[model samples]
Target: MKTDRIMWGIVLLFIGGVLLLENFNIIEFYWGRVWRFWPIFLIIGGVNILFTKNKSQIAGIISIAILVITLGILFYKGQQPRQKEVTISSHTEESNDLDIPRDVTYSHPYTDSASVKTILNISGGGTSFDLKGSTDSLIIADVQRKLGNFSLETNKTDSITSVSFKMKGKSKWNMGEGGNDVDLKLNANPIWEVHMNMGAGEVDFDLSGFKVREFNFDGGAAALNIKFGDLLPITDVNIKTGVADVKINVPVASGCRIKTKTGLSSKDFTGFTKLEEGLYESPNYKTAVKKIFVNLDGGLSNFEVKRY
Candidate 1:
């Protein structure tokens, strides 16, 4: 019995130290994803409590149990080292009598929406309806709330026309958009053309796995990324910005004509090549057998055009 007491005492001491470290911020804890393995610790401690007649032994066992369980949870979450992940805090609710809706089958133009107007926010999320095989809809999203982790996702298999989505914010997201506007980030796992306006956001768009055609980019105090290697049967492309960094990726087959402009600042085309010549520049220009054109403009910060 005495030996058992000493054994439990050592376990208790170790657990106590772990608790202290946690309190001092030496380790972080996450109660979000992993709470499944917890019962094992409690069960062990409980079993020890039922068999151990000595008070000290039971106490030690319980303390050690708690410590092991706590640390296991912290370590399994990948948050132990402290890294930032893109996460959003948003709500989706259905409300009828919403603004309005119109369908466009031809080139008539149409629109759709999802908004919670009473939430005291200048922020909202919704999808722009598209024609299964053609482009006909124009998007106009006006959100005016302080935002963090804003994202827009469009269906990958559908066809659409002229997407003019915009975001405005009142903060600095390492990406900029003065204040009072929507912020945009797009990642579509399908093939489609995109025209986006990120008022102030850290916008990263990836088409590396799909096809793309006619893309336009506009940023206001933000970062922009458009990879052309992901686009197929390319038709045209353009990029414009107010204040931020821009990165464009194209393929060598992209014989597309491109134009770039910058604000009261210097431009960076270290990403692009063969500027002294024209579209039919040379065999090295890698013209995209298909007819295509690309135009680019930027204001303040860095701009780039490189092959993906």
Candidate 2:
């Protein structure tokens, strides 16, 4: 506890200094000035109590209160600025290189191949492919022939097609850190599949508003989170973890079934729907899983089936 308190003290002192510096011309990122001060309030008071003596009184308490109230207002006001809803239809063809289905609009696909997919001996820092605001396009990430960091993220206006990815991992000893962070938008509702493997590193994903056939997770030791974006529901999901935190979110009316060995039961997972044996419960259930399969592997945090 004492060690933790010292660490907190150091962190707060750093934040306060940064904020104080930013308040003047020392910094200029518009967000930096107003945003940096928040850490001071959050940490100082909490650390003061641990530091004892005159620590918890006067300026410390005042700073915490200011931080708390400022945060409350900032959040409340931030959410109030809702964008006007514009009608978006993907039914018509916007271009030849892309597919815009009746209920969706998409972007072009990627075509990269390798004879040895998994063992891509990367000698540089890392290669990156970022997908943004193509909410109706299906993305196929084939890591079955990939080596190196595979990082992917999508905002509220991105989507994928076919809903499947081909994934694979090298032999156990060859795996390393740094996988992918797939950010799902609150308004993303396209059906897609993901297949990727990680040697190491935390994989953070958001499933605020999404629909999919299933998820495939394999290998690695890390905590995973499957959380909702606000209050959202997703269906047709599957996951298997070696050793990590496993979470699942089930919405009312969406069909959910989890098939796993008893090993996944020990970790903390909320709202789990256990399936009975290898049973394919329905034509609906069978079709859902077949429609799209997203596979993920190895990350320190958040292995999720999302709703965005």
Candidate 3:
């Protein structure tokens, strides 16, 4: 067989095997760590080009062996836990504009006047953001960082309160040293609409105690884990991602529906019945009083929805 065809077959086999293992939960692969080694592809391509002109059997064997060895290394690394000591250095000249890093705590007092509806907007990248508990205050945020500037602003218009928390500048991420970490808590008194835009990082949010009407996330190359509660009659979640691992959990008692527009992505929806292409619903969807609707749009991602 031609070396080119052999190389293509090997690539396909590797990809298919990894996807199968990941979908079945037999192995957990971290794409984030593997992505950093993208230069391996370039090396493989250069070797193939150099040997293609020589049609000798030895040339083909050498090319195939190199491809297999490189893929093996990638497979092994992908299965390993992400190293906390990994550091991401920024090469952009704009890095000098970043502010001195500091640790800060912010709180916004809750008042009855703006309890009707609350909108929370978060924007940042290269950090970990988490929401775990409810707070008596309107919102509380604790930020620990080694770089970048963090700010929070709030405004009230009639009965709706809008809160915006964001990182102001770009900075290098030295995970071995320290990076931006934000822990957040929000009041459960008012109905909430949350929107988050992040370039990359990890997000773990538990909004089970809050009355969430709408939740939206737009991210790239990230790991996202979110659990939603049935505090409201209807909850809508919309997520758009690029190269991500997304896991969502919903209460088993609530009716849930999922609509996905994911291309070349692996999906596993446990305890869900397929109604049609790109649509799934829980068994109690038609009769349950409370319902959740999730919409996923992603590219090259792993998506899972589990009823808990």
Candidate 4:
């Protein structure tokens, strides 16, 4: 059998097994956690291609076994009962290292002011998120939750700074309700790249007071409201969600264009001119000195865009 075919067969088998286990209540698999491991499949395919030639069925069988074992280990660990809840910090891969002493406020500043770029990665799994601009420091992150439920990670380099928020415990789908709550302030001086991955919650991002170069939001069954601030240094904004309701505000003076790709969803962009089926442009988009471009993709969602 061809290596590509063998690899795909193994992948299908693994997915089928996972679904079977899920059906039998033997394991509850979170695809988000396992999605990062996709690169391993490429490696497996490469190994199969190299070794499974000239009727070498042993190589293909070994490759399939390896994948099965890997997935088995993941499911086994996920099903283990922790002495306490397990929180995975975005800053580190080791989940057992989180030790939250009490229900206290935690703060971390950008250690070096010389860093020109800041990337804020907030994984607000089933939580409420509120973020705005701040001049108090390079970045200020504040998270409030039950003790031992969440943790923060900060990493700084000469050219970049990164901060992440991660949660612990059994997380359920957030359907417009509560989970981890976060309030963060970001410095205006450095170029900012903000990425949020959230689930079943509400997100309010008042970014009009900050200087942001790029922003990306990904959510699962959530509600998102964003207000753009003055001096948007970046031109591109991207958002993807599943079963979400979204509203966005763009500064009136900023020329803006919106392109939406969705499935069975509704959009209200009243003031903008529709250039095509799913593309829109502001009145001054061609003449304005600075412009904003937005791209959205999702399914069964509500989207609205307004000029403020």
Per-model TM-score versus the true fold: 0.41, 0.33, 0.77, 0.63
* CA shift of 194, model 1, Å: 0.9
lDDT of 2 by residue, 1-308 (tens): 34334445554454344334433546422221122133344464564554455444454555444545655554444224222223224323233422121223222333322111111111111111122222332342322112322223333312222322222232222221222222222124434333434322223344434443334444343333443222223434445444343445444234344343442123222343334542222224443423322223322223333222
lDDT by residue for model 3 over 211-276, one digit each (tens)? 999999998767788999998999999999976789999999999999999997789898899999
Identify the candidate with maximal TM-score.
3
Name the runs in model 2 displaced over 4 angstroms: 1-190, 227-234, 264-308
Query: Number of clashes in every candidate structure?
Result: 20, 27, 0, 3
Best model number under lDDT: 3
Q: What is the C-alpha lDDT of each candidate?
A: 0.41, 0.33, 0.81, 0.67
Point out where model 1 deviates above 4 Å: 1-191, 270-283, 286-292
RMSD values, in order shown: 18.6, 15.8, 5.1, 11.5
Writing each residue's lDDT as its tens digit, candidate 1 over 196-273 gives 544444444455543555566554544455655534555567767654555666665655455655544334344345
Candidate 4's C-alpha runs over 4 A off are: 1-102, 111-115, 132-135, 146-148, 172-178
Residue 229 of model 1, lDDT score: 57
Query: What is the model-wide C-alpha lDDT for candidate 4?
Result: 0.67
